[model samples]
Target: MRARDLVTDFPTVALDTPVHEAARLLAAQRLPGLIVVDERGLPSTILPGTQVLRLAVPSYCQEDPALARVVDEEHADRFLRSLDGRTVREALPRKPRELPVTDPDATMLEIAALMARTHSPLVAVVDHGRLLGAVTLQVLLDQAVGT
Candidate 1:
């Protein structure tokens, strides 16, 4: 199947979307990541779930992971509060990774190859620069194993 055939409506977050809201969506939907769109509704970047977690963690904890272990469970639970007053744009890496995109006619192998090469769990399908939908890794895997 081609990208269009596999594409399914998926959640997307805008650059200005509240970080907490994005985190909620990720948790509620159990998504691997979210497609970040521009004001024009075009895919701009992909925000992996790990990046959101990274934003919640303190730099000190990241710098020295052992520091993370020292934090009591009660305080560690509050780590996500760090994302308060933050926007999705702020959660993004300073240098964005290449967006994994494909056209409607792209073959499954082409999509798989792109996913593998980019290490992205989602691929945005664009037609004439407009997002049609997305194909997630789970869907791709299900199709691959013929389950």
Candidate 2:
């Protein structure tokens, strides 16, 4: 099967966007991370769950409980800080900024290798250099389920 069929309508964020909005998306949608996309709507990188933690915790104590407390105590502050106007570009990792891509005709092995090399859970589904969707580990595992 093709990646297009596997894409799971996951959440997205802009690269230059502030760290805050992604946090809210995680809280509201209960997602682990968001796909950071460019202005053209192409994904630039995957913003892992941990980055949001850094933004939530204080510099001295960066623990989950403390961060959760910060959230509880500073909902307004955090909300105001989130993706207020920034794009994903500014926040994208300097390393491996884009998800690995392959033609629709490529085999799952090729895509899997790409994912493995990059250590990314997802591979952006592209066609002729255009963003289409993404394939993730969950989708791959789903096929093996119930068998």
* lDDT scores of the candidates, listed in order: 0.91, 0.64
Error of 2 at 21 (Å): 0.8
Give the TM-scores of the predictions, in the order they appear. Answer: 0.94, 0.64
User: Which number leads on TM-score?
Assistant: 1
Let me know the TM-score candidate 1 reaches against the reference structure: 0.94
Which digits, one per residue and each the tens of the lDDT, describe model 2 over residues 1-147?
666656656667776566666667878986656777777887667666666555444554544445545446556455446445654455555666446655666566676787778766667776776776667766666753732
Q: Top lDDT: which candidate number?
A: 1
lDDT by residue for model 1 over 55-88, one digit each (tens)?
9999999999999999999999889887989999
> Candidate 1 — worst ten consecutive residues by lDDT sum?
90-99
